[model samples]
Target chain A: MQLDWFTVAAQIGNFLLLLWLLKRFLYRPILAAMAARQQRVAAALTEAQAKAAAAEALQHDYLARQQEQTASRETWLTQAREEVVAQRQIWLAQARTEAEEARGRWRTELQREQQEYRRTLQREAGQRLLALVRRALHDLANAELEAQMASALLARLHALDGETRQTLAQAARDGCAILTAFPLPEPQRRTLTDGLQQFLSPELNLDFRSDPTASFGITLTTPSQRLAWTLDSYLDGFAAELQALIPPAGGDNASAYDQA
Target chain B: MTISPDQTILFEFGFVRINATLVFTWLTMALLVGSARWTTRKLSATGELSPWQNLLEVLVEGVQNQIRDIARQDPGPFLPFIATLFLFIAICNLLAVVPGYEPPTGSLSTTTALALCVFFAVPFYGIRRHGWRGFLHLYLEPTPLMLPLNLIGELARTVALAVRLYGNVMSGGLVAAILLLVTPLVFPALMHALELLTGLIQAYIFAVLATVFIAAAATAQEQTANLSQSRR
Candidate 1:
């Protein structure tokens, strides 16, 4: 085999031309396309990562705001509940106070009304008793009853202690007077006068007077000392005894009265 | 018949002669350049590729990958030269099956021309990468005693690249022609099929060896530096 210098030279020239042609046509464009595609993919990945991070930040912010709002709502709810409870307590206390004041006023009014009613009842009962006594005295009073009353007076005088007797004797020296519900006969007057002379000083002088309002009783008066027994005195003593027997009304015990 | 297609002189004028090997090589170069021009006329950079563009991309990308794998370097500087070598040899050998068509690669002249291109390309890439002084210094690697041996090894490998491809392709054609005369039917067809496989493998080996030789020269300084660092 022989190497032909001319053919070798020509073939070498041809191979170099082909190399130039292929480089221009094939390698450059394909490599450029591949590089462009890789760049696009990398950029897309970076953009997606940025978007995802932003979305995560937004989610975190939303969650924090939601938690804050929830806390605020809880605070408002608790405050509202407390205010409602406080208002309820205040209203309850005010209602209780107004009710107590109303009850106290009602009790005072009731007590006043009760006292007025009791006074009215006592006045009516006293008037009725006095009327009955007056009617009995009108039917039964005579000269004999008068004379018996005179004897009762003398008995009361005789029952006095020694000091009372001295007081009456001294009062008789100051000038004595006799009062009668009715005018007496000469004999009765003289008996009264003689009874007084026996109990007092013999030199004492007395005047007799008549009082029409002193029903069924007699009274003796001196300038400094007096002694009398009258229907009015006995009726006053009877009313006082009745008042002591009945207890006083309690304050604001309307419900207690219901139990009673 | 002449043993070499280069001896088949188609024309002669004074000292200049034109032969079948030159004609066939020119025809192959025309086919390659014409097809490239046609395919690249309406290239689409960003959209769906036409079938021609797709085929071209596959070929170019495949060549780039092969070069990168062999060279262990960026395929950009070596891709076109290496790809052209493989395509020309493979196409020339593959077309041998055509009636009345002689493969230019069957000639020692074409194979030697390709090996000589690789031989020159190795020094070209080395000098470009590390300058002339650094490229000359690689022969004295490890010790200065290895200079002649390294120089012989470089020439020997280039010669081997040319002889090996020429021998395989020429023998396959010769065997097919002899088999056609002997048993014209199945044996020749079988030999032609075997030739197709062998032709492709030889083309691949040529291109890979070219890439390896060039890459070794280009990165020799770096390799030596790495070796020194590794020793340390």
Candidate 2:
């Protein structure tokens, strides 16, 4: 076999014409459609992402607002409790003060009434006693003219034991004796000097000064000691004896005597 | 180179002698038609194709895929034309193996015709895609001064495609013939294998060049359109 030029040329011409026709009719439309579809898909994805971001932003805002609302509510509640507590304390204090004032007023009124009642009872009792006394005297005056009698009665109180008596005598004579007049009474002076000499066991020098304020009393004086037995001293001793006899309700007799 | 009595009988057609080459060309066309029909009948979206149909589909799909990648578009509409071109060239190359068959691509006339078809189709598709103005603007690509160079480049590409296939296929056949005449036994088998290789290579070159031309036409048209719009 050999190569033929004419037939090959005819065949090639046919193939080229066919290719041109196919390209014109087929490939371009399909490519355009594919490109458009890709663009649409890309746009959709972008829009979806944008929507997701917006949703996230909204969620964040809602959460922040919720937290703010909760905080404000808590503050409001705390403030309200403080105000209520203050008001309640103020009311309680006012109630307690009013109760105390009412109690004070009731006590004052009761005291005033009690004083008036006491005064009335005493006056009534005194008037009754005076009437009774006058009646008895009138009755006794006629009876006394018929008969008269006279009698004397005496009782001896036992003195304390020796130790007690000695303790009392020593306490009474312990301080220095004093003479109030410029010239002492001879008996009183001698007795004071003798007592001091005996107690000292030797002769003692004494000085005396008169004080009108130490009236009607003997005061003995020595160079280092003095003793007072004035009327003011006697009164003071009597007062002390009376104070010891009447002890305060809860105090001991010994403590009362020591105070006197 | 003595012609046999049967060869002479087959050559006499009316008063003019019809070359054995013409018969081989007819045989190639017949083979193309038969294969095309067989491949078409086996085409199914459902099960596997027979081996022959599978081979045809692989060849078609390979060319189609190449065109689609280059053209950056669907090659479905162009499949018939490209597949036919590929099959025709393949069959023409294989015809060299048949007892009295010759390769059509080895002839200058056939190669020139193929080149002319590619040349004409490039402009035709460019015009179809971007109109007549766009087709003319292919010469003026890059700049007005580039028009002559672009034209020359286009001519050169066509010539190169035609000459490349013709030279390669013709030399292979010549070598096989010379080796067969010299050592008729061992060399013929080696020549046959070499011829088979040559045939496949030339077929591949032809299909690849066709795809490149189509891609260039489409791209040029796109550029021309863009230029005109920018100018506007």
lDDT of 2 by residue, B1-232 (tens): 4211113225554544454444555566665655555445534433444676556545655776877877787776455555656666777787678776667666655666677777776776767766887678677777889988888988999888778877777777778878888899998888888888888878877877877787778886787788779999
List each model's interface RMSD.
1.9, 8.1
- Model 2, C-alpha of A248: deviation from truth (Å): 88
- Candidate 2 chain A weakest ten by summed lDDT: A148-157
Pairs of residues at least 3 apart in sequence or in different chains that clash in candidate 1: none
Provide a comma-separated list of chain B TM-scores, one per candidate: 0.95, 0.83
As a whole number from 0 to 100, the lDDT of residue B130 in candidate 1 is: 78
Off by over 4 Å in 1: A63-260, B1-16, B38-55, B98-100, B142-145, B225-232
Best by DockQ: 1
- Candidate 2 has what TM-score? 0.45
lDDT of 1 by residue, B73-165 (tens): 888888778888888999998988888778999999889989999999998888888788878878899799999999899999989999999
